[model samples]
Target: MMTVNEVSKLTGVSIRALQYYDKIGLLHPAEYTEAGYRLYDDTALERLQQILLFRELEFSLKEIQSILQSPDFDRDRALDQQICLLTLKKEHIENLITFARGLKQVGGMNMDFSAFDTAKMDEYATKAKEKWQHTNAYQEYTQKNKGRSKDAEEALARGVMLIFSDFGKCKDGDPALPEAQALVKRLQAYISENYYQCTPEILQTLGAMYGAGGEFTENIDKAGGEGTAKFVERAISIYCK
Candidate 1:
């Protein structure tokens, strides 16, 4: 058996982090000392090792917890899956390193990207499906946004980006000014033009998501600047209200 500190040292994780894991029920101690110190037996250590390995392979904490705690989880199957993923990652990283080293040697750029491994492309698609399935809001967004044409959507998108760009210039928490309101109107018209029958409910929900969701945050930040998405979202809320 090992104390929490010993386990932390062995795992190279902080003692505080181990304590947090224990608190969160992610990796509880196998035993407790008379002095109330946490202790980990061989089984607990093994579990910790698996958790660490899964984390290193880019599984989220929640994903790891679900997999570990699931009734159908098999140790051999888990190990096999981890090995497959890690091998793919290793191959990709090796290719990137080779490319970088070659670039360093050649000085000027004449590199071909045709050697890109497309074998793991389906992994991202699977992950995206799983992510969309996890949230009703995101699923709804996907349903609404999916299958919309590029040509039809581009005008609306341009209008929305302009609003976001203007919003980025404004101070946070300030009331939506006349110019913002006018932009919101244009955005609503654009949505109506594309969405066939844009209901207030759908518009309101979308506006709320744009205001609060990290997806919109990233989108707006990418387009204009950080907080531009939030500002546009707020303005949409005001206009819709």
Candidate 2:
């Protein structure tokens, strides 16, 4: 596990910015020490890499958070897109360098602005953003959350965690127990009512994420207890079947 200071030094992201990312739910550390210092694992670092790449593409923090949190988010696919965008940026820069060098050699006005055009890069970025942001679930979530107050949004988040807290209470018991199954039902209903439709497929994906050892797991375990996320994932798996 790496401390927050280590992460800052390694990634060159300011400690303050990391703190802000935590505050805004952009990037959460893997865990916290008893003394309340943040600790991160490889998974968190990988997430930070994704954030940095998106930032290089000029994506806003909000956009990055949304893309990362999306149920449809695919790390491999995102990396592929980031690589393509970076290559395009590199090509644009090389073109500009060549253009500048030619102008200097000629020592006269060359008025060739073609090197500055970024239409290809811009088009690719727009399409990528649309793919990340316009998923049917995301569109529904956006429509449902339109005009919601910040406090209301937070309250909804708290409501979801409270369900996880209930899951924590039964972590030691059989996940197929009636109470556990009931909690799964409640969770599905709550998500369908608030965020997006909690289809069995989506819920299964979310269950995997809950135990996947990152922010969602950390937050769920924080709400419940250690192993709570995994227990919930098991329960959800049974419920889905």
Candidate 3:
């Protein structure tokens, strides 16, 4: 058991914010002591952890409460998802900083958007690819994606995009219907064509990763809308089963 102050100190959230959360029922204490002092237990501590995660994800307090109180709420899953998002945000910020530095190197008084040339991008790709080839993570990704021709991979990507583009047009539970099932089959076939025997577990994990990670979200959302990504995730989940 811990007091509100203890939780504030442990989490680096201000004491006032913790008190406000209690008042708003966002992270209420387990019970109040006889003297009216708030008391929190293990469950409350865990809830606080979730609230902190929402803050890090830039969710408003109201949004955090709704998400936490949802039937599908899962702290570990939320944390895992936030970690993926933060990682992608970190990478994008780094890239932007590097681009800014490149502009500075070209003796620009300010960010010279005009100086940004796509034609010069190929000059950096060789070094970037060489660096990735030497990294364990890139090597693993390469081996995982190997054996598929570039053209075949591109076609598979297109098939997946087509499914995303048409997301949410069908009625609820339509994924089990003939047309939806056909789409799922097409997606499954694309995976099989690109990779060596994508197992059921692999398919399920890929769905989770898609929801958890920002890059996957960006790609799927670009294919259609944000709902399209969620629909793809649900379809993948059902197909994997």
- Point out the worst 10-residue segment of candidate 2 by lDDT: 62-71
lDDT of each: 0.65, 0.88, 0.62
Lowest summed lDDT across 10 adjacent residues in model 3 is found at: 123-132
- Badly placed stretches (over 4 Å) of model 3 are 96-241
Q: Which candidate is the best by lDDT?
A: 2
Error of 3 at 200 (Å): 26
Locate the minimum summed-lDDT window of 10 residues in model 1: 132-141
Model 2 segments more than 4 A misplaced: 1-23, 28-46
Give each model's clash number: 0, 0, 0
What TM-score do all the candidates reach, one by one? 0.47, 0.84, 0.41
lDDT of 1 by residue, 1-241 (tens): 7988788878899999888877655777866888999988776887788788767556676556555543223457556656776777777888878888888998897658844764583484356336424544333433555565545445655776776676666636554788777766766665555443345565666666666644346557656677767677677777777
What value of lDDT does candidate 3 attain over all alpha carbons? 0.62
**Residue pairs in steric clash, candidate 2?**
none
